[model samples]
Target: MTPEPNQLLRPSLYVGALVLPLLMSTSALAQSAGGDWSYKIAPYFWGTGLSGTVATSPALPPADVDASFGDIWDNLDFAAMVVGHANNGRFGFSGDLQYFKLGNSGPTPGPAYSSVDVAITNKIYSLNAEYLLKTSSTSEVWGSIGARYWSVDAGLNFSAGTSPAASARSKNTWVDPMIGVRGRTELSGDLYLVGWAYAGGFGVGSDSSFDLFGALGYQFTPTTSGIIGYRWLSVDREDGSFQYDVEMEGLMAGVSFNF
Candidate 1:
């Protein structure tokens, strides 16, 4: 039997269903543990631009890409992003999920070429265990370690003159060990500064991946807050005939709820 074109997305979707429930359960568990347990959920948007190179075949050189946020928005077919955090005492857990599909078309370089159309699907999941080094009313710092799972499916189709259309597809999936640090400091009564950074890969999984995020937040209520921030992420991977090197950076905004 032939597999469906979207079959590549099932693993992440199934895992996400299982993990999201666990994230919700953490809040109840934390609430039962004591006053020390705290849980937060945030839904965010990242206006990311893509910049890098991609190669579908060894015979062809990698194509350079520089896409702005508007380009991605124009090409985006679907997207979802959400994050959750829970802590009890000095021990805590964090989970983040991101998934998207994009499509783009461009004219071929020379007269012999008509047009090239491309589609990309990406899914990433991050789960971490964290430990706080310092904690106070005004400030706190912590470090975390976990795994990051990545899956990407890409396809290209093109037609030139009267020739039949040609198409190619590639898929890559891997898990990497990730480590990072996060901190928050109070700037005033209801305002705070927060930052997080992490990296994964060491000749394992993909060649390398890193992320940086920072934000300023204002508490609207004891249980809710609004955040504005910036984020940058980069990834490099090479597996047989598949190769992808990309970076995304943008401004972000979100709202967080505590329970």
Candidate 2:
């Protein structure tokens, strides 16, 4: 169902101000390039703020939305994300999964209503196939093609509601085709630089979508490392009269395991 766009909270996607490096060390992945297969997994946290315009139906004009990192933190009910990568020879693949829930409550006049509550949940997934375009003992560059999927659910409920004052819910889902390139190189012993960018949509699903990332990684052991960086992501979509333009920017941190 589509509901009126009401300055809904937006989580934006990943990517940010500093070309956020990452917890997943691509340099480590580069070091593993060979005839044998290698794998890595990592979990990430993004302290993000979001801004944009949204409309459930063109019947109503789009509304501006601005959500600060602090506001999101206060209403966030849950969040989780995991990324995995595997490669053999010059070919490989990667997958990412993320989920988040946000909620808000407001008091209302008595008599018929007491309070109103709003809840929003989001789920996202991406899968990509990769091919090495350049490689060295300490660095590598890859070309990739992928698909991303998104699902959003929003609902509102009122307490002590009278006749016709019920609850409402809205849900939306879509997929986008993407292409991008990423690479990493050792800066010095045990330290590396990484970055990647991708674009999609093109009217297939959304009108347009983009993601950017960069980071520095530190390897503490053969199988363990960590990273910190900034990231930014944005997407524009329209379904019938519904349209949404969303942008997310934030800081990122995470740990990775290579094997």
Q: Please list the Cα RMSD from the true structure of every candidate, rounded to 1 decimal place.
A: 5.1, 9.2
Q: State the weakest 10-residue window (summed lDDT) of model 2.
A: 11-20
lDDT (tens digit, per residue) of candidate 1 on 7-114: 535644754686579776886777677777778888776656666766576643344556666675665555556788888789999998887565666665554447
Judging by lDDT against the true structure, name the best candidate: 1
Per-residue lDDT of 1-259 in model 2, one digit per residue for the tens? 2222332223323422111233245545666654577878877876555566544533223444566665656554555567777888789887777765655555544445555565656677788999999999989999999999988675656566452344656677899999998888888789988778999988888899998989899988989989888777788877765555777666777898888
Q: How do the predictions measure up, each by TM-score?
A: 0.82, 0.72
* lDDT value for model 2: 0.70
Predictions in order: lDDT: 0.78, 0.70
